[model samples]
Target chain A: MEKNKKNKLSIVSLVKKYLPATVALVPLTIIPAPAYAGLITIAVSSTGALNFGSLDAGGTGGTVVISPAGARTQTGSVVLLSGAGLESAGLLSISGSTGVLIDVAMTNPAFAITGPGAPMNVGGFNIDGGGSSVSLTLPTNPATFPLGATLTVAAGQTAGVYFGTYTVMANYQ
Target chain B: MKNTKKGSDIGKALLMGTALVSLSSYQAEAATGTGLMSAIILTPIDVTSTQVLHFGSMSVTTAVGTITVVPNGTGGTRNAGTGSVTEIAGAGLESEGALQITAATGLVMNVALTAGPFTVDDPGAGLPMTVDTFMGQAVPAAFPFTTSIVGPATNVIVPVGATLNVPAGQEAAVAGITPATFTGSYTVDVNYM
Candidate 1:
């Protein structure tokens, strides 16, 4: 009977020794994992560039518009000329959880394209068919869309090729 | 021993509940894309002189004479002023200077001229002539004029004319070989109004 009591005591002591470590691990396992939204990623197509094509900014300046559909038009003294590097809308490919509502936006609503001549203003940024935001279509893991904007050319805009960079962002809604 | 085990289990359950409550919140994720924008701008407002002003051949006697070339259409009308001067008809085509200004349609531009009583001299030892009263057949009928580039046309042509003054007993030929030939230059300035 004395030996049995000693064994019980030793077992109790072992449980006591390990109790602190067990308690420390309990919180970690019991804490529910937070639900996470799918990560959204956006990229411009390799062959895509927002191009206004060839234009003649006559004696009086005007604006050139490139539609999301890649159609080019002009107003005022701006003349549209067809040649190499013809007008095209920028193509954006988005990848994420399908059916996730997304909000797309231009980091800079208005910016400038500069070259040998005076800088031209680029504004009125829009997505394909028009709108600042878009919803990812269902079942389409990687969705593609077009982006377009208006270019304000100064009167007597000097002759040369103008270049600039613009940024866009996509976020889970 | 039963009492001690029950108390430890109760304490662990309370801590677990607290941890679950603290960890249940949501956050948003975002991504960005960069795009290259480009454009090509062509030349604007190109001005060129298509034709030069010419004064047909003329003969002068002992009296001072003058030749007035008026800007008509593409050509000019030459009139001999009061003196012993005669125009040698069929010698050459006398035309007014033509300046072709290319720009955007419906654009209005201010036209200016650097008028000169320019001296016209020959290669030989002959009397020199003077050209003055530089004029352009433009709107407002005077210097410092303005022209509108009409639609369906990207350019406009302005005709320029002038007057030439000859001295008495002007030489008829240079080195007594070729007919006396004179040449000079003038200026035309244009700007956006």
Candidate 2:
């Protein structure tokens, strides 16, 4: 009977030793963690459209390229026009938590621009300053970047205004 | 036993909470934006042959000779290489081959001619004469030409010329009673450079 009483006392001592740590965990589990509030919020918007100005695709077709710096160039039989407006690269505005590294990508790298005539292909998407990835600087909620691409004009491409849509995605790295 | 069970429940709750937080964070950390792409296409380049190249009538003697037609607009000159060959001069008898190319003004283009030593055959006579050394004369420029400037007023014209080889003692058509006429063709290709 004396031995049985000793075992019960030891059990009580074991619970006392571990009970404080277990009690500490209960509040942490029930109160809800505040780390959720620290999650970064990311948003992307377009500031301007990517424009390749007037061009002539001669007997043999050619390609027109727009650089991230908003400069336009061409190859093959494509001719650049001296119209009133200047060609420009696409502009994107990204807003996110400061000091976070962000990745930039084109959901559709290659697509076609349609118009009255045949469709012209657009590809070779690029970004300036940083390629494919960028970091948000301190004190700036929204960071802006430039994007560019190449347009393929077919031989005897019908004369008209061509239009296409592209998607740019931003994610925290 | 009761304390141990309570600790286990707390651990399970912590794991579930952590999972929920991860899901919420992922949903808010990514976004997509759309941008417009645009281009304006102009008219395409066009080319056509305005005039056909013709080498005039000639008579061969006892020696081998050649006839050369110069490519100089419509009034191109024809010359006999050897003294033995005689060129029959007549109105509308011979002229240089001409091509009219049209494209955007100031656009540069390349002109190519495909003519190897080809035979000009007269069906009446079994003997055939070979024509070779084809050349092109581009106005505002010389032969072996590279670029032609497109026009605000007139399209660029390229006149072609070649040499015709006549064998010694060549036979006439229809048992030497009627004149023999020979004919063959060459290709001209033009493209924007």
Candidate 3:
């Protein structure tokens, strides 16, 4: 016929080029095959600070503790201020604030601790008798303010407690 | 020329597979950057002078005499300040507050580790006990100034250039210093110069 119509138009142009390449493989196989394949995440961040350590001659309100393994970076929080003023006139205040948390304890091998209050700063005459009361009677330590709650040291008692060693500094500014 | 050389090898394999899918999508198009700052730290309780317990302002004479203090040494450096102008030992008088000995040039100095050796009696006396509190620190207690103590190391720190040469006649020994368990305290401003 024209040669049989050129072989049926080359078999209808190879079925229209394989029917759009088999319809692009049916969207790569029914499209219901995504299986969520692109995403992953995890996060953590905590800027740091807590450098507390200083209670020399801790006689007025007496307290000292800071251990969390002595800390360098425990994830932060311990501000305690008031450092310059020891020419010897006496005006050192550390009752609270500077990153407050005045007394939080537990140490001896166990860590994470604190207790820094009572550096009350006084000295016009409360010398040892603490007569007008400035806090000094430490026997067996009921918090130690011993002058005579019947703590008994009789004889001629004048002044005692000779312990000294300060500078408990800490920081992760 | 051969179908344009087979369409330039399929456009060079689609630009190398679109750069291998954009370098494997670099961990899903990742991007992160951060920074922060603020500082000022210091914790110092360095009341340095090393060690001192000197005295000598001139009007010294209360009674239990033996005065000679000043790094002199007998026990360690010098311990020849044995004084006594008063004798009243047994204890019973607790003033949590309201105690003052203003012009007695007071040095109720009580450093007893007692079992024995402490006495203060004079001023005719009857019940003139006068404790005002000793080691816990606070003699004048608080009148027109800051006063209160009971701290770590328990104050002996008189560092300002320190020169407490309490000489004149020196007398207020009452040091029975008992510490089987007895902490310390003081507030001696015997300024009778």
Candidate 4:
């Protein structure tokens, strides 16, 4: 019996000495594996309308030009009637992956301006720089893009209000 | 009993040593890597007009004068008091041009107007009068989008005013019957900024 007791005591001492190492082994199975993959996304929004406020149609009539930079000029019978909301270039908000390229295109090159008088043609649409398609390098954050347009005013283009529609497309590159 | 306990201790130590070695092997095999993917989406933008701008009809006089039509009221100097700017009643939302825009929530937008003055010519007399200085007022006071939170659409009302300069002794549209119509097209551009 005394021998058996001595043997049991030695075994217990061995377990106590190894208990710390067994506990330390638990962490090896519990540590989380690291993730190595990620994804990127992009989006866009609008700010306001492009305004070409007011112009005087001289007896002969003429054309009004709005530069992509929002500069205004008049020709022929068309006189730039001075007033507020007179002229402003269109603005757009582009956002997405930082340091990425984006392509912009206009679906319609020309549209009609219809109002009280006969329908008038509004052509020569330009965005940012002069061209049908333009490319931009998107910033890491959201940014603004300016668009300008020009219209062909006809002789005796009646007197009244006019409206038209156009489309702009953007693609991630 | 002593033999049984001794045997069990040996078994336990061997089992623990095997587990420790297995754990070491797994730690050595631990490996990692990384990858990347990209995506994007867009929504359409739109604006619908609710009201048409109108500067009421006025009578032309032989004497030189001007007619000014502002949002609050329409009044300019009329020689002989015969020529005046009158207000025209209309159906629906009054005050000028009203527009509704649709786009992504919280998106910012810019409103731009470009057009010149209007002109009226007398068919019988072959003379023209000019309506110059076109001005516009937005209901919110500013042309920027305050919020797209309510929905994808925002409403805006714009009231337009203009000035008319009539040359001295300008002929009327008719002998004493009709008022010549003066009309022209204006362009409004809206976009995301």
Query: Which ranges in model 4 have alpha carbons more than 4 Å from their true place?
Result: A1-45, B1-193
lDDT of 1 by residue, A47-152 (tens): 3889998777876888988889898888987767654447899888766667767777777778899999778899998787655555555247677888888999
TM-score of chain A, model number 4: 0.68
Select the stronger candidate by TM-score from 2 and 3. 2
lDDT tens string, model 4, B38-104? 1011133456665555445555556666655445322211222224333333322223434455644
lDDT of 3 by residue, A82-129 (tens): 332211111111121133112211111112221232112111111123
- All candidates' lDDT scores? 0.73, 0.71, 0.23, 0.52
Candidate 4 is scored at a TM of: 0.37
DockQ for every prediction shown = 0.27, 0.28, 0.03, 0.03
Ranking by DockQ: 2, 1, 3, 4
The deviation in Å at residue A63 for candidate 4 is 1.9
Please write out the lDDT profile of model 2 over residues B117-192, one tens digit for every residue.
5778877673677876776763424334665554554467777777788876673332464567777766655654
TM-score of each: 0.53, 0.58, 0.23, 0.37
lDDT string, candidate 1, B84-191, tens digits: 567777867677888899865664677787666577787555787888777777321456688868889878888888888888767443336456778777777775
Who wins the lDDT comparison? 1
Stretches of candidate 1 exceeding 4 Å from the true structure: A1-34, A37-47, A135-139, B1-28, B50-90, B93-193
> What range of 10 consecutive residues in model 3 chain B has the weakest lDDT sum?
B29-38
lDDT of 4 by residue, A135-161 (tens): 777665677777666765666555445
Given candidate 3, what's the lDDT at residue B102? 27
